[model samples]
Target: MLIKQIIIRKKAQEIEKKSPYILLFHCSGLTSRQWRQLKNILCTFQGRTLFQPSCRGKLPYKKKQGGFIAQFAFSAGPTCILYLIRKTPDNTWSQLLPSAFYKQNLVLLYGQLQSTLVNHMDIKRAVDLETVSVFQQLFELIFYPYNSLCFCLNQPIQAE
Candidate 1:
């Protein structure tokens, strides 16, 4: 059963080459080692950049995942700045936000609001909370001033 599960996961990862724009936000507490499989799979394709700048090996801050994805975007030869909205709702994923909505959404994404999907996902509540908190802090400190594009990817489940 474990072997079957691993095979399925690998197949899914391997087959995701179609959507180049997919934003991969790593779940926290997982090391870069966990990303090795993804890196290896991405290496097979040409003209694709698989950049993992910060591994946090012997770093001062805790080992969290956020800016690795954002930093890659910043370094991808773009001129504008970017802000990574780690906890924004799924709506923000598909559309642009107004000035007021941007500010408010940024706060809500970074805050511990029960209304957010972070509190209701299938994952453990404690783990989700810590991951969201870490994502907010690291994203602000590392990916700031790059507000040319603000990104948020939220996955909400139906209550039924």
Candidate 2:
């Protein structure tokens, strides 16, 4: 199974030069190593740009869950910048104010709130919350500026 997966990935990489943007979404519990592998494969095959965002919770086997979170946005050049965010344990949302920093590179946002922002399909439009605290924090981060073209991947029942 592993060998077959690798072979398929190599074939995919060979053909990625034709696609404009490749958006990948993974569940919340992936390790940094797995994310790195996916990033490498995408970078190698797609020959375009790649971005991966950290989840709200700590990845399994990771030490710190909420500090120096690394986010990426790739372009067609040799230079790349690692956009870092600091997650607070207090559950307060710290707005990473958009600057001229992220003017380029296609921004691909993930997470629950991202779905509503991208597709305009509000979950809250369907379900109501009586005492919503964390939901507010989540929304603030998702609906912030500079994240106009967000895309949400369907959440998997089990982490891959």
Candidate 3:
């Protein structure tokens, strides 16, 4: 469920009082100095913000599930990924996306997750196979298209 990239259909400046705010969550795996990109993205949204304090733990998942879920990255090992979430009115979301978004973005992203999972775990364990399967399942739980605003948007949005 790692969020590799954010694809906002609208420009940051377009967010109005009625629009949902985009909250960028940078995982602890991301160093403080590396937040330049996240900062830029935030600035595009006019720099409105709220703060929550979280420090990394040496034991990975021992104390960071909240952060991991927020950023969609697993805090299991050295492997880390960039990620993003979009909030739209559930109509223009998909229409605004490229045709091959799932194929090009999601499929490739899942492949990377499997690759990283292989690197982190001791495959010799009998449960590793199940672990991978569950990972795929949970991954879907996080990024399922059905949950997206643009899940089914063939019809045009009617203007108010």
Candidate 4:
């Protein structure tokens, strides 16, 4: 019985190691299909598998089932940026910067915000002076191209 348990564990480990998780995020108002062209490029690469989410903004697989290994985006070139949104003590939403920088090849930028009223979906219809101002600030901080991708974890970041 002990030997069988050990063998089962080993098989699970092997399955986990077989594929690296890659998260693809498209800019606001765009669908995950924004990465369709890039997916074609990555599919040709060796040892890479593509998993499309059943619904937009929803991850296809659970994290414990081998969480994402890397995040990829196409800008001027292949770039990876980590964006974080955190609730502040002032009872407002704001962006947080990563403590450590990413690799030179990876191209990660960091920025912070004091507060914002709009969440993800509402950014489009943010007509209020304050909401529109916050939206402008976000775009200025991270000028995500129409077809670009972003990386975020934990709570879902809005994308069509």
TM-score of each: 0.28, 0.29, 0.23, 0.22
Model 3 misplaced stretches (Cα beyond 4 Å)? 1-10, 14-18, 25-28, 44-47, 50-160
> Which model is ahead, 1 or 4, in terms of lDDT?
1
Write out the backbone clash pairs for model 3. Answer: 3-82, 3-83, 4-82, 4-83, 90-149
Better candidate by lDDT, 2 or 3: 2
Q: Per-residue lDDT for 34-142 in model 1, tens only?
A: 3344444444444444433334465432345544443332232322112232234445424423432333323221212355542221111222221121123434523
Ten contiguous residues minimizing lDDT sum, candidate 1 = 119-128
Error of 3 at 16 (Å): 5.3
Better of 1 and 2 by TM-score: 2
Candidate 2, after superposition: displacement of residue 81 in Å?
Answer: 15
Candidate 2: list runs displaced more than 4 Å: 10-19, 52-160
lDDT of 2 at 151: 20
lDDT of 3 by residue, 1-160 (tens): 1122233213233333223322222213443333434444443443343232233554344465444333423332232222223433434334323432332232111111332322222211212121111122323433543322122122232222
Give all candidates' CA lDDT scores. Answer: 0.32, 0.31, 0.29, 0.29
| Per-residue lDDT of model 4, residues 41-116, tens digit only | 3444444444422224645343543233222221233233232122133311231222211111112111212233
lDDT of 2 by residue, 1-160 (tens): 4564466455444333332222222323334554455445444543243433435775543454423322221111111122222222332223232331233222322323422322221212212111111111323334442232222222232222
Candidate 4's C-alpha lDDT?
0.29
Which of the predicted structures, 3 or 4, would earn the higher TM-score when compared with the native?
A: 3
RMSD of each: 12.9, 15.0, 15.6, 19.5
